[model samples]
Target: MDWAEVGTLVALLAAGALLSGFLAGLLGIGGGAVTVPVLFQVLTTLDVAAETRMQIAIGTSLALIIPTSIRSLRAHLAKGAVDTVLLRQWIVTVPLGAMLGGAVANLLPSDVLEAIFAAIALVLGLRMLIGKLPFLLGRDLPGRVGRTVAGLVIGGLSAIMGIGGGVLNNTFMTLYGRTMHQAVATSAGVGVLIAVPGVVPFVVGGWGRPDLPPFSLGNVSLAALAILIPLSMPTVKLGATLAHRLTRRQLEIGFGLFLLTVSVRFIASAL
Candidate 1:
């Protein structure tokens, strides 16, 4: 690519990163939802092969999530909104699940992965949109065994979908009666758990592949990470601050709308 073209791409990515960072803090999502799609488009522009493009995007997103989640978690921690007990319960199991997910993602087709992301997002979006009547499993969170299983599922799916586990974790927490603020805060911690271990399998899976783009480490693109990380970090605090300011119902509506939009976009891409 020419210098002008590269500059344009960087500009586009920078914009996405800023938004992703804000969403990370605001929603505790670690910004993978935005990062993955933006990276996929960038890869497409670089003429990356369709088969590997999604994996690269997902891998890069996970890598970016590590720092983004940390920043977001720290911001939420200051507010005393995080649910430490729940985070502790899932720390071990979630990482294991993320590793398993990364391995599974390597075997799956890109379209299939997109479909999974879309389907889950659609369901969660619809659930959140039905604001007045939440679909609850019980008045309290599940017991240890149940929480472990939930953690596993959250980790695995988030890994595959290139998310920070916030979407799934938030849903899980809220279904059991936790407040939206608490769910968002705790999900930031979950993102840290999922992303730290999730990135390894992707690195191993895509290592030295012929189809990869330049400056790649397995399925991750160093260029994209370099551009995204710095731009995304500062905005996380801004988003976290906004998250605290918003009302619970407002937060739920916003989250629902964002998920639904993402779902539609991915579904179309998959098709």
Candidate 2:
């Protein structure tokens, strides 16, 4: 990369680090919702291929979230908020989903992928903003069916949107009667699953596409990953540690508002 490109990457990473850490600390989301758009802008500025930009953006964002998720996971674990049993079950499902989703992400037209993601963000956003999350609706069961359903959709979308699927997972759990702390902690674990498989297939599928950009590895963007991964880790750690301490009602209010905003922005951009 050129000096200008290096400088821009550095700036984005810096901003991403701060924003990521704050979001992690506040929301336990590991910054994918934020990362996608930011990476989208950076990939565009880098003259990444029009055809593969979203794929690269999503893949690179998941790649970057690797360290961040580890950091946050440790923090949540330290606070005794993590649900290992649930995480163990989900970790099994998500990676499988990630690989399948990655393949599907590559096969689908980019427009279709973007519209579906935007729709998810819009619906989730509107629900949160209205303070009417179905999770808080006081419903109860073992959630087997719900978990399976969430896994499929979250896994698919995680690959297509280039997220770790924690946002969707957390939302599902929260609505399922899991407390916010448990949901956030469990979501961190979900990130680890998606990041690994998500990056691999994206790279595999997008690798030789003639229309792709210079440094892309399949659907993943190496340049952005090089800068973003290291910078996002500590912030995620800080965020998870803080999540264990934040009040539930306050966290709910804050996370809801943030998702609401990000959701709208994503929908607007995709539209």
Candidate 3:
């Protein structure tokens, strides 16, 4: 790539990492909600094939999520906001679902994936904005089997959308009568689960592919990972701090708006 191109890419990625890191810390998200779409836009300017673009985007997003989730998890831990028992219950099924999701994503087309991501984001955003999306099953988090089902759904969808499981987990936890702080904190643990086993299927699925972008391994972009991880890691603490300061309603509104914006971007891409 030329110097000008390199400069632009650096600027774009740096900005994205900064915002995403903060969001990850604050919302217990993996930052892939922002990173996946942003990275896809960046890759479009390069030589990657359209067929593989979404795969690479999702894989790379999952890879980048690893460190971000770790840092976010620690921050939430320090605040004593996490629900440990819930996290433990979700650990196994979440990753299993993530692996399955990665495998399934490889079978879908790019536009289809984009559309799915956009639709989910839009629904979530509206629900958050409405401030009361009901969970009719109960006012308490479910039993082991119910949790396993929730974990599977959250993990699978997150893997397909290249996100941390935070969004769904946070909403689920809060709907089940947990405080938002507890929900957000536990969601970070969900990110840990999703990102760990989640990354493997992506790599394996894209192994031996010939048309991948430069500095790629399977579907993961080494270049993107190198830039994003470092840039995002340090900022997570800052976001965590801010998260604690914000009121529950404020956090929900902010997260809702962010999802709406991301939904629009993904929809635009699909079109």
* lDDT winner: 1
By the TM-score metric, which is better: model 2 or model 3?
3
Ranking by lDDT: 1, 3, 2
lDDT of 3 by residue, 1-271 (tens): 8999989988998988998898899888998988887888888888679888888999999998888989899988988889999888877899999999988988898789878888988987887787756554467998888888999999999999899988788778877888878888888889989988888887888889888887888989999988898999889998888888976566678778988998998777666
Best prediction by TM-score: 3
Ten residues in sequence with the least summed lDDT for candidate 2: 132-141
* lDDT for each residue of candidate 1 in 17-60, tens digit (9 for 90 to 100): 99889989998897787788788888989999999988999999
- For residue 232, model 2's alpha carbon misses the true position, in angstroms, by 1.0
Q: Between the candidate structures 1 and 3, which one is better when assessed by lDDT?
A: 1
Better of 1 and 3 by TM-score: 3
At residue 62, give the lDDT of candidate 1: 97
Each model's TM-score, in the order given?
0.93, 0.84, 0.94
TM-score ranking from best to worst? Answer: 3, 1, 2
Count of backbone clashes, every candidate in sequence? 0, 5, 0
